[model samples]
Target: MTDEHDWAPDACTLPTAERPLRLAEFDRLFRDAVRDTDRPSPRRLRLRLDDAAEPVVRDLIARESACCSFFTFDLIRPEGDALTLDIRVPPAQVDVLDALARRAAPAPRP
Candidate 1:
């Protein structure tokens, strides 16, 4: 599986079997992709997925971000067979995250 950070940019595809892709697979892929060497960001992550997390496997758009105190999700692509992980990190902790992320992010691709 390709570790594409921009879930929106990289269109999700269905893995051969039945539905889309396993949620666990998505987690493994993304977690590996965003492996922070220094320390894991203190973001209150939540996967507010529309698809039923069950029998039917589906591709997931797992979010990893920093945001406002309470984040309200709007189902922009409800019909789309993809999981939505609305990652929300307290804004109060932005600066600390910036410092950490800057140091953690892979060297900018020229």
Candidate 2:
């Protein structure tokens, strides 16, 4: 069970015209594309993906930021091949971010 107070702001907050697709759909695809995750500290997380996914990831981040203004995202492209998405948030929002990280983590192999 969950209360309104316990809920995080979701895609519903955005205007219907602005949301081409639901957040859950984007998150599902995003999680599948994520290759790695690193948590340097309690307040920050770094998610890595191959170059091919960068454009979609960038679009996703843009939409996510519009709905969830509390989070700060930095996209870094290294010299080699991967793209890193660094996300930071206030301590109170860490739980929300953690949930996102958990969702984004790659599925385990059989």
Question: Candidate 1's residue-wise lDDT over 30-84, tens digit each?
Answer: 4334332333346533233334442222223323111122322232234644553
Best-matching candidate per lDDT: 2
How high a TM-score does candidate 2 get? 0.77
Candidate 1 weakest ten by summed lDDT: 64-73
Which prediction has the highest TM-score against the true structure? 2
Q: Which stretches of candidate 2 lie over 4 Å from their true place?
A: 1-12, 15-21
What is the Cα-based lDDT of residue 17 in candidate 1? 46
**Per-residue error (Å), model 1, residue 45:** 8.9
Candidate lDDT values, in order: 0.35, 0.72
- Please, what are the lDDT tens digits per residue for candidate 2 over residues 12-110? 356645444554655666666678889998899888877787778788778778777888999898798578988998887777777667767788869
How many angstroms is residue 89 displaced in model 2 relative to the true structure, after the best TM-score fit? 0.7
Per-residue error (Å), model 1, residue 41: 16
